[model samples]
Target chain A: MNKRKSKNVFINGAISSEFIGQSIAKHQSKTTIGAHNIFLGQVRADEIDGKKVSAIEYTAHEDMASIKFHEIREETFSKFDLTCMHIYHSLGSVKAGEICLFVFVSSPRRKEVFSALEYVVEEIKAKIPVFGKEIFEDESHQWKVNS
Target chain B: MILHIKYFGLLAEVTGCNEETLEFSKNSVSDVLSILFEKYPDLKEKDFQVAQNNEIVSKEMVISEGEIALLPPFSGG
Candidate 1:
C-alpha cells in the first residue's frame, strides 16, 4: 500500500525565486540525500505573426489535475530510487521569463536524480491537462498547444 | 439523464461557457458529442478529447449520469 499523501501542486501565479530557494533550504535536515536535481520551466516570449507574447494565463480541471499529479508522483517513486520529489505549477497569469513550473527530485546518489528528474518532467508535460492562453502584447490571445 | 458538460481551454471560448447541463437520452460518448456539435458547430473544428467523469474515454465508451469535459491539447510544462 502507498502511504504517501496527496498534495496540492497548483500555485496562484508565477513561482518566485525566493520560494524555490526556501524549498531547497528545507532539505537540510535530510542528510541521507546526496544529490538534488531541479527543473524550472520558464515562460518564453515568442513572437507570433506580428504580435509578441506578453504572458500566459493557465487553467486546469482541478480535480483531474490533482489526481494526475498524485499518480505521477506515485509512479515516479516506484520507478526511481529517490528520497523525495516536489512539483509546482502556476494557475493564473505568468509573465514571460517567469517561472511557471518547478520539479525537484532528490536521491542518495547522482544517477537516480538525473534519470528521475527527466522522467518526472516528461510525464508532467505529456500527462497533465493544464491549458495555457498566450496573451499578446496588444491584448490578443491564442490557445497554446504542446509540441 | 441529466449530464453535466464542461468545456476547457479553447473549447470554452468556442462554446462561450465553461459548463452547462443537457438532458441526454443516449448512452455513448459519441451521442453526447453529436448534441454538442449541433449546438456549437465550431467545436467540430477544434481538436480535443473526451473525458468521462475525469478520465479520458473513447467515443464508443458508454456514459451515464456524470460530468463530462472536452479538453484540448495540453500545453502544460
Candidate 2:
C-alpha cells in the first residue's frame, strides 16, 4: 500500500478516554482489520528530593517531530502488514495519571498488530523530538529522558 | 550567512529563549556552536544533538542558511 499522508499528531492537552473510544468506533467499518492493539502513556507522579510530581509539560520541535513521525509511519507500513495506524501525543500540561501519548495499530491478524504496535511505540520514544518537563508539586521542574 | 537557531527542552531553559537568529561567517555546525557557546556559556554543559534543515547532523557537517535546532534527549512516549 502507498504510504499515508502526514498528519499532525499533536493534541493540546491530555488525551481523553472518550476520544480514544470514538477512534476505535470509527474503525469498526473497516472489516478487513481482524485485530487492533493500543498503547497509552500516562504521566507518573514520581517523587524527587521529597517533592511529588504534579504534572508534565510537553514541548516539541514540531517541524522535525512531524517529519520524524511521518518517517516512522512510512517505515512501519513497509515493514508490517498493517491496515491502519494512528499516533497522538499531548502538548502543554498533563497531570499525573492522565494520558499523554496514544498509539493505535490495526492489522488483519493478531500477530502483526502486536509487533507493529511495539515498533511504533519504540520509534516514537527514540526518534521524535518531544520533550517533557516533570513538574513537581512545589513548582520545581526537571527534564525527563527516555530510558 | 544568517542561520535560524532553535533550542528545545532543557537546552531552551538554559538559553532563556526558544529560538533566535545569528550571523555566522563560517560554514560548519561546529562554527555555529562555538559562537553560541560564547554567548551562552552554560550551553556547553548541556547535552544535545544538532539538527540542520530538520535532520540531525554532526558538528563536522557544513551548513548554509537554514534552520538549526539544538535538541536535548527525547522523552516522548
Candidate 3:
C-alpha cells in the first residue's frame, strides 16, 4: 500500500500459503498484466541408491539465513524490472514432497515476467543459507547442502 | 576464553549436539578447527567449511563475541 513497502521477502521456519498470498496482495496491483508466473518448489520423496528419501528436516543458522535472504532480495529487485516480487523459504523441518520455497514474479509484459522469475529462483537457490537433511524411509538421514 | 560453536550436517552427528562451548584463545577460524579436530579426532577428515555470523569466511577470519561459529559443508541448491 505504501510506496516504500511493496517488495519484501519472508525467510522463516515454514512458509504458509496465507503468507504467500498476503505478500502478493501487498502490491494492490492493478496492472492487469497479460501474464503472471509463479514457481513453487516442493520436496519430493526419492530413492537414493537403495535408500528412499522419506522427508527433509530443514534447518539453518537463523541469523545468517535471514541476512542472506535479505541481501538476495535487494539484489533481485535491482536486477529486474517487475511489478512486484516476493520470496519465502522454509526453515526447521520440512517433510518430503512438501513445499519448501515459493517465488512469485509479476510484470505487465509476459517476456520480462518469465526471465525475472527464473533469475530470482536461481539466485535464491544458489545463495540462500537454507540447509536440508534427507531422511531415509528407513529413518537414516544425511545432510544435503549445495556445493 | 570459551567459544560456543555450532555444528551442522555431518559435524553435528559427530559432535552429538548442535552446539558446544569450548575453551580457546581469541583466534581465527583455523585455530578453532585445530582445537576441535584434536578433541573430536574423527572430524578432521569430513572437512567442514567455516562461517562466522553466516558469511563464508576463510581460515584466518577472526571471530569475536556473540558470533555463531559454524562448521557447515556446502549444501545449497
Highest DockQ: give the candidate number: 2
Tens digits of per-residue lDDT for model 1 on A31-57? 999999999999999999989999999
Which lDDT tens digits does candidate 3 get at residues B1-77? 66768887677888788887777885777887888888888888786666776777898877774455455554443
Alpha carbon deviation, residue A129, candidate 3 (Å): 2.0
Ranking by lDDT: 2, 1, 3
Pairs that collide, model 2: none
Score candidate 1 by DockQ. Answer: 0.90
DockQ of each two-chain model: 0.90, 0.92, 0.47
The parts of candidate 3 lying over 4 Å away from their true place are A1-28, A32-34, A145-147, B74-77
Q: What would the per-residue lDDT of candidate 2 be over residues B1-77, giving only the tens digit for each residue?
A: 99999999999889999999889999899999999999999999988999998999999999978899999999996
Off by over 4 Å in 1: none
| Candidate 1 colliding pairs | none
> Model 1 Cα displacement at A137 (Å)?
0.3
How is the predicted docking of candidate 3 categorized under the CAPRI scheme? acceptable
Model 1, position A58: C-alpha lDDT score: 98
Across B1-77, the per-residue lDDT of candidate 1 in tens digits comes to 89999999999999999999989889899998998899999999999999988799999999988899999999997
User: Could you tell which candidate, 1 or 3, scores higher by lDDT?
Assistant: 1
Local error of candidate 1 at residue A23 (angstroms): 0.2
